[model samples]
Target chain A: MTRRRFCATLALCGLAPGAIATALASEGHELRLGLTPVFLDDQSIFLEAWRTYLTARLQRPVVFVQRGSYREIVDLLNQGQLDAAWLCGFPFVRHERRLRLLAVPLFQGRPLYRSYLIVPAGDTHTKSLLDLRGKVFAYSDPDSNSGFLYTQFALAKIRERSEVFFARTFYTWSHRKVVEAVAVELAQGGAVDGYVWETLQRSHPQLAARTRVVEQSPEFGFPPFVARSTLPAGDFKALQDVLVAMRNDREGKKLLGQLNLDGFTPGERKLYDGIASMAEKVANRP
Target chain B: MKHFMRDLSLRYKIPLRVLVLASITAILVTASILFRVYDETRNDLLRHAESMGRLLANTLVGPITHDDVWRAYEIINSPFQGGSLDQTQIAETILLLDTRGQVFVSTQPTQYPMLSEPGRLDPEYAAIVDLATDRNDVKPSVVDPSDSSRLFVTIPVISEGARLGTLVMSYPKSLFMPRFVDIAQRAALMTLLALAVLLPIAWYWGHRMAKPLVRLAGCMDQIGPSVPENLHCDLSESHDEIGRAGTAFKRMLKELKEKEQLEQEIMASERLAAVGRLSAGIAHEINNPLGGMLNAINTFKRHGPDDPRTLKTLALLERGLTQIKDTVAALLVETKVEIHPLSRRDIEDTRTLVTAEAAEKRLELIWENDITEDLPLPSTLVRQILLNLLLNAIRAADKRVECQVYRDSRSFTLVVKNDGTHIEDEDMAYLFEPFSRLSRNGHGLGLWVTYQMARQLNGGIVVESEPGETRFSVALPLQEEA
Candidate 1:
């Protein structure tokens, strides 16, 4: 089987890398990770490498529950239906009382990414989010930090409700979908994840060809892997150690390279205070 | 109404038709626009309500999944507090129904949160909950049956492939009705504006269009049976339909004038033909008699002259010859009309010639002359008129014919009266008409020639007749040298 296909199947079957033989012999615990489709994008090669390396380090079966919506994945994570999830800082802060940060993926050796507001390439009217008032808009997800929450925070800064500012809006449930929707003019503007948009621009230029970035939000903490607050102490520590030390292991390094990510880091809670403050400003907006 | 419309004048009819057509078109267009506006407003309102309902359902999904009823209630009540959630005033009430159709959370807390099961709640809600539970994949939509203006949209909250509950949102059509009304008002105003602009133009156009036709009609009316030969209308240069009609009318008038002239010429020709026919017979009889008289005169002149008795006889013969020559000279037809003054002697000579015919017919001829001075007129024309009247009177009178001639400051009148059968009323109207044949004695060119000659002299003739007395009067205006 192709490495990606094998790894995806193994992930679906909850088979860890070194524990594959043991997984076949005994009933292995299923480690469910709530994932948004934006980070997946059918990149089975990278997806398999990441899952295989993580599973090998954890020495347990790892399974992924793929839902297009961030809100759904966040809710699943909050409900403890998923063992852990890689969640945006906005949703992470939203469910902070019930969720705890495990680790944050570092890109360019830093745990930070910005929010991008984009429009069709030929559009010259919208130079920023404020110019998109009363226009049709697409948001990746209601819970997405860079895609939805940052836009809300920006509008909240001007004392405007995003729902009222836009003529009409709907969620595409994924950052790549926001780009595609904007490219096709299905939406006049979009709020999307900067990391996902840039990655697609480099890897799939054709899909990003017709979209132009109108504005970017201040850099915030990159999305971090999170688990329920009530997760067992030993299990949480094991997942955290595996993610932070991934750059040292040969297979983990290879997987990290394929994912265009540096090793994971123990993200400080204060690093996410910016997203939390924005989220609080939006939630408390009158 | 139909008869009234039919009887309306073209001037009124044209404008009325334009008004009716324009009004009907305006009404139809306005109605179409209003209907479309109402339809679109209704759809937009429904869509907006549905979208709000979906948003509320998504927001409540988290709290409901966590079984946090208080948070659900708080979220449901947010719209009523003039918050951003219901700033459009689309939702009137919102209720979160558990999977069993029990109202777990509601904005209208006192009235709702009904403890009833799925089957016993509002039928539409129950139906929606049933449908959502049966098919979690399908979105449930409902509108209140009792009031169509109120929309009820139900959204199923599915968490982890399990039906958590149904979110029922109540939104009335009142939210967008004002906007619809404003649109309708605008449409009506526009239609009225169009009508206001168009109607006057239509009226003016109709008036301009009808004017030519009205003028043409007036021209037609003026063309009566006795229309003057010089009648004309001025609409020949126009290019519209009415103009075309005017042109056709003018052409017909021209033809009619030509026909009238031809008829008058024919009447004059017929009179001349009658005169020619009588002249032939009169020449033949007069010539024979004149030859005998001339021989008698010549023999009398050659045989004897010195005796007083012979002298008297020769004078008598000379007088007879002179009278005949005068009568012949007076009867000759003259083409060119010339006026002359007449003295008492001319009347005496005319009476002397007609006295024989009157005596032969056994009629008493009474002649009166009130004119003392010489009368200046077309002598030949007056003589012809006098002779024709005298003849006709003599023929009609039982035993007496009266003739009187008078002169006034302005005119000269000749009155001829006869005690004979009166002329019939029907015949009197056309009595002066050419070739008018009433009876044997009247059916000739004698009277027709008299009528024509009088008109040529700028005079008029009238015949007034009753049972026993019929009078013919001829009057001519006296024109000075000019």
Candidate 2:
């Protein structure tokens, strides 16, 4: 519904886009995706819409299982319960070894977005993630990139220099929720991916009415669509080609627009390899 | 033991039943109030405690989430105290813990076991912990050791797959503590107020009741044959039992006083009547002898010149004659006197009349009845009544002068009083009866006839008597009716 939540939900799915390749290659295979947002029993019938879309393309039944957060997506992918997911850069970095990228989302013509630490328009204390120590910090999702992990990565950078981040951290669950948290003063400041924050400010003024961007992190790849690493190599390449050429076909372009992604690129694992390496470096350094 | 016996033996006293009822009622009412108040107060205390705990936990949530761990204690103190939390009056401990088992804050940290040490989780605590992890939706709840109905709430801080800490609070269930306690206190106070008001009313009523009995005793003390007048004691007009009894008792005494007065009046009238009848006849009878003595003395005086023997004989005769006259005079004085009756005259009135009452007692003659016939229309009843009294009187005259009867129109009045000391009021009432006498000289018949004749003629009588004189007057009704 909201860009921030869209990103979080993308991250909530416990698999990567490449997993579709494996499902396509294997006969009698069941296509599965782990969605991290909780599924209430009321959504059982409504989820059939997603099943229909996936089944028409794969010529098989596509199943969706809900998890509470992207951490669960990563856990599920590692456990092989998920074949693919639409995931944020943070958890992708953590479990990239177990996932494969199929597509990267594009906003304003680019696949890069920065994390912004936002404060209420009148707040005077915090200017950056590093300055948030002993002050309230709001994160959209613990597994979110711009909402949490990137800001956390900024903390990771400080920790590299032997410093701690904010004195306290709280979860807002989604990008929209994070901005809402700052607006409502539930937290002093919030961190969200830059594109999602701008998009939310334009769409939901009440959520952004009391907030302003105080700081932003270095740009990172936008949340990417990925499959689990266990998907077959040939099937992975076919899925990649199909996604990349999507903008050229009318139906494919509509699908790409529906998913809010620019045409897919001939993705090399190298772009995400560095994020994984950085996370490892941060985890190891601490 | 004395006090116990006093309380127990109160049964014999008039107010024992009232006392027992009052004591039992006071204790029963007070005890019931005390018990109810105690229970309600306890419950209210518990409810207050839980709310206080909630406020502290909610306020502290901000500081914990912000990681400003130290400010947590300040946050709690202000809210718990500022709000209506009275549970601080009781001993309690508040604790806050972080995910790493680090103690963040506590109100009375000293009361708790060392926070740094990992305390052994009882089965329940361990279960709650496990529940928080699997499902973040499960809120941390409260525990109450004093009452089973405790309440609590918990909030978990989760960020990026890491657990920050848990906010746990516990308090008792007090539904009616303060309100019910107030009620009990009020009941006790009300009972006391009722007693304060009621005791005086009861005493006043009791005093009213006792007053009549006390008056009865006082009146009894004044009693004698001629009792002094009784003092009036006021009592309630209420128809309550005591008032009714008092009214009735006063009425009885009044009746008795009237009866005594009536009896006295009747006896006095009878004695005066006796004296009346006696004088009229005695005055007439004594005149004859008195005339004879005068004639004989005159004759002797005329014939006396040179006869010595004759003179001597004459002197002897004169002396003898003078003695007889003195005897008659004395009889008249002694015969008539009025009577006075006392409240104690019951025994006196019963004694029969006798004669010569004054002479036997050595009394002097002070007055004599001088009337010969007291009625305009003379009756044999009056004549006989007179003779009976004179004969009786002659025997008792002793050294008194002779009596004479006198008469007049409009008043057939008669009186004969002896100078000899009159009989006491108690004895005079009996003097006119059949065999009664002031002394032992005669039987009682003389005054009985006088009494009967006076009454038959419908005459009224009156008596006046004291130490030196006794006088009686009988007024014959012969003063024709108009």
Candidate 3:
């Protein structure tokens, strides 16, 4: 694949609906990963701390790559080269064969984050998925639970129009990006994780001022870092054990502190299966 | 290439048209037939392969496994492998697949170079992966990406109520493609050969038709201004429409030539008659110059130009020049030309001139007018006829001149008479004859020219001149053809 397409594929790995760990548990060794876009020490400081910690503990170098589109990421994952990824819910439902999750992120003592459907501050749209019709809506990524899966479930409850109702729809690949899409009017409204919104309110009040919450959905599991099926069985076991025990250890807590998490939890594989089902229900939205 | 284009451009246009039309029609017909044949043949081949594939896959129904699919593929491809069958004969293919969605074998293995790799993935494997993983509802289906010109068939290998996987079959479709290329090349070569054969026949037909027309045009151009005309191309020599037309044309040309020769004779006689009348008028004027010059030269023998003789000689030279000028004026008047921008006043002017001339001749003229307001005759001819008659009457009149101009819808008449003369019936018949003078110091051509001028305008004149009264009248018919 071309370098540009490789980058796009790497980016799409996050948009795919799955935690990389579940896929990695069944995969062979090496744990090659297609990560989301890079960190700028802003909304992603926690990701860096976790990666640094995970690599140190696992005693293997962690590789990060950027991809352009969610479909390309899933393509790489299906190729068996991409052992793990942190993806949004779309690819998980789209390519469940190559992907699954491990542990989801937590902040302020909660294992979940509410998805905020935000629009411009003076916008007339009210609470409901149907109200956003003929308006541009954004998703942070196809894989993020709050960004896509839970919002997709909300849409299923109200109206399933992921394909058509909106005048336009897009992926911004991060909760902060989804909020920016709505704030800057690139999209009329978007689904963002509540945690990212709160942080933006604290750090960039101008961005927070640009948008207002039009609707809120029930909480969904936070973004998860997964391993691939290609990873050795022993390595997959080791990685999951370490992630579950991070809150109990002093160094892990300190590392977790940098990412603003209360603790990590032992996630069940079946916990995100409902996300896939939610996608199916919403796929035929009229 | 430049010369080719120039030669094409220089092609004789009439025949070029015929050749182009014929070649284009032939080529379009041939090409259309060839394309139709190619499409039908290719479709037939593909259809056969598809049915064969279905039958082969049916053979695998009890055994839709990897090994069975490979066996099926091998069995199907085996027929075309040896020299017994021509690969170039519209190559086409069919495929059989096992349940795992793998193309276990192909009819032509070398066609898909990538498939040679062991454990290699399908180029569209991503799409297959998505189809297999994402939707539980969409069953085994067939997709034809005709843009890529490949046909893919995915069959479900369902046995004993369990989904074993997908049986994927891909047809490399380029088999029929190369056949079309060969057919097109062969078709083009044949079309070229046909056009080459047909062009000369078109030219031959075109030249045969146009040859007579070209010859006629050449003959017309070569028959210059003064040639005698006749139907020279013999009608009796050939039995054809052209021969009849040539006979008719020659007769028409002969008639026209006679009319033209008659007109010329009249013009020459009129010129001679004018010369005679003009010579008399000139002599009187020239006599005055001679008389003055003789008197001046006698004076010059006694004195010089600085003396009394000089003024007299100058006066005589001026008189001679004036006589020459008067003769020139009359000559200009005689050669009748159409007065274009013809107007009502010009005819009136001629009528008035006749009356005035008769009055000057000291004849008690009796004049009458019965002419239309707008006479449909050129004023130059009108004036000439009136002047010629007046002049003749002045010469013949012993005491009186009688003049008449009258017209009805279809004719015009001019008559002049002198009561000083009368003639016998025999003499009256030749009264308008050239040089037949009846009186002393008289030019007889006046009546003759008047007679000829009338005829030129498709009319004639009669006269009665005798001792007591000589009458000359000219009648002109107004024909619509004029």
The TM-score measured for candidate 1 stands at 0.37
The TM-scores, chain A only, for the candidates as listed are 0.88, 0.73, 0.73
lDDT of 1 by residue, A1-286 (tens): 1233345655655543445656645874657777665464456556656766666778776676666567778778778889888888888887889999999989878999899999988787777888988877878777888888889989988999987998767666678778876775657789888888888887789888789998988999998889989888998999899989988988888877766688799888988999988888888999
Q: Which residue ranges in model 1 land beyond 4 Å of their true spot?
A: A1-286, B1-29, B78-89, B117-137, B140-147, B160-163, B189-203, B223-225, B228-236, B261-482
Q: What fraction of the reference structure's interface contacts does model 1 contain?
A: 0.00
Put down candidate 3 lDDT per residue, B238-293, tens digits, no spaces.
Answer: 44765555566567667768878678656655765565566546765665765676
RMSD in angstroms, all models?
A: 21.0, 16.2, 28.1
Candidate 2 lDDT by residue in tens digits, B301-381: 787575888778877888877776665543343323332211112211211222345455554434434433323434444
Better of 1 and 2 by lDDT: 1
lDDT score, candidate 3, position B352: 75
lDDT, candidate 1, B409-454, per-residue tens: 8898989999999999766655764445764664465776677677
Model 3 stretches with alpha carbons more than 4 Å out: A1-286, B1-22, B65-174, B177-200, B223-482
Task: Order candidates by DockQ, high to low.
Answer: 2, 1, 3
Order of the predicted models by TM-score, top scorer first? 2, 1, 3
Chain A TM-score from candidate 3: 0.73
- Candidate 2 chain A least-lDDT 10 residues: A37-46
B14 Cα displacement, candidate 3 (Å)? 6.3
Candidate 2: residue A151 lDDT (0-100): 62
